[model samples]
Target: MTKITYVTTHGERIDTEAENGATVMETAIMNAVPGIVAECGGACTCATCHVYIDDAWRETVGGPSSMEEDMLDFAFDVKDSSRLSCQIKVRDALDGLVVHVPSRQG
Candidate 1:
């Protein structure tokens, strides 16, 4: 398992453990960590799972696909650091991953 810390836009922080292979949003929703709605269930078709991966761990995360990028355009407060959590597969490399959720999402 990995310890993923989620910080909401209002600065609320939630720390939880997640199975190594689970997508970041899956963990959040399962734990009810708040901020991630995951409206499309990790299909990369919804921006409701939008998150900003911590800068320190950015290099460790996989890049977004064209579909994820296109959908991200619809998220609240979209930024360069934004990512669709459903697109990030957790693993050993992401054990200490931290992401910030925007204040709003579907």
Candidate 2:
């Protein structure tokens, strides 16, 4: 399982284990991490699962795809590090991934 950490807007840290091929959003929902609303259920239609990729993990996580970027337009407080958790797939390389949840969803 890949280990993922979610730092909430309130400064709460939630750690979770995710299977390979699972999306970060899926893991967040499964682990009951607050702040990842996932309103569209990973469909890339909504940005409720928006998160900020930690600087250390940016290259590994990569930038959002064009489609994802377009969808992210609806997210709150969009930033250069902003991403939709549903677009981030878990893998061995992402074993220590860390993400930050926004204060609110779009």
Candidate 3:
């Protein structure tokens, strides 16, 4: 399992464990982590699961793909570190990943 941390807009922090192969959004939804509505599930067709990766984990988490980038256009408060949580698969290498949720979804 991988450990993922979610920092909310209100400065609340939530830590959860994700099964290897699950997506970041899935981990959030399963753990009832707020700020990730996942309206379209993990399809990456929507930006409801958008998150900003912590600077320290940016390179490891990497950037959004073309499709994910297109979808991010519909998200709120997108930044250089913005990413679609649903597009990020959980893996051992992703343990300790930290992401920040926006104040609101699009």
TM-score of 1: 0.93
The global Cα lDDT (0 to 1) of model 3 is 0.93
User: Could you give the C-alpha RMSD of every candidate to the true structure, in order shown?
Assistant: 1.2, 0.5, 0.7
The TM-scores of all predictions, comma-separated, are 0.93, 0.98, 0.97
The reply for model 2, stretches above 4 Å from the true place, is: none
Which structure is stronger by TM-score: 1 or 3? 3
lDDT of each: 0.88, 0.95, 0.93
Residue lDDT tens for model 1, 30-68: 989777899889888889999998899887896688888
Q: Whose TM-score is greatest here?
A: 2
In candidate 3, what are the lDDT values of residues 20-106, reduced to their tens digit?
999999999999888899999888888899899999999998889999999999999899999999999999999999999998887
What is the lDDT for 49 in model 2?
97
Q: Show how many residue pairs clash in every candidate, following the order shown.
A: 0, 0, 0
Clashing pairs in 2: none
User: How are the candidates ranked when ordered by TM-score, highest leading?
Assistant: 2, 3, 1
